[model samples]
Target: MRQLIFFGWNFIFNADVSPLRHIPDTKRRHLVLQALGLMWAVSFGIALGSYTVLAISVLGHAVLIAAAAVTVATYTAAASKPHLFMSGLGRSRDGEHD
Candidate 1:
């Protein structure tokens, strides 16, 4: 039990030894940090009865979800119809510069 507590403390306080380092993508790391910030915001809002903060955090979460959905849709569309999106960009269908 004591070892587990110490591990948790180290994980929270020691950035150099944290699990975030294992994530190779910078965007994913940023997303994780943003999520942690939102969790803290929600916790603070609930603890202090700040409905405004809670609303803002909820809005932020919604924005993130929307952005992710748009990104997925764009990728899917691009994959399905690469020519439609990539045309007039000085590149050919074979990815060669014109």
Candidate 2:
């Protein structure tokens, strides 16, 4: 949660600073979220294996899959165009249209 908050803050504040910043922050956040999702999948998969119960572990795995899917889609989308996510960090050129 804390890591997510930090990522959000960076996204909100630093996104417009540069294309490089946009690429790294987007990629890093995706990676972090992916790791967390993997942790959930593995932990619950193991729990389900040992107990033969299909409830808690199933819920956990579903959550994991959902998180991973969302992040992957988001990152892929962001990888295109990019200026959408890099909305604020640049100095405006006079009379230049974006």
Per-prediction TM-score to the true structure, in the order listed: 0.39, 0.33
lDDT of 1 by residue, 1-98 (tens): 99999999778644556787687886787688679879998998787876777889999999999999999999998889887775676547677664
Off by over 4 Å in 2: 1-52, 88-98
Highest-lDDT candidate: 1
The window of 10 residues in a row where model 2 has the poorest summed lDDT is: 12-21
Evaluate candidate 1 by giving its C-alpha RMSD to the native, one decimal: 22.1
Overall lDDT per candidate, in order of appearance: 0.80, 0.72
User: How high a TM-score does candidate 1 get?
Assistant: 0.39
After superposition, the stretches of candidate 1 with alpha carbons farther than 4 Å from their true spots are 1-48, 89-98
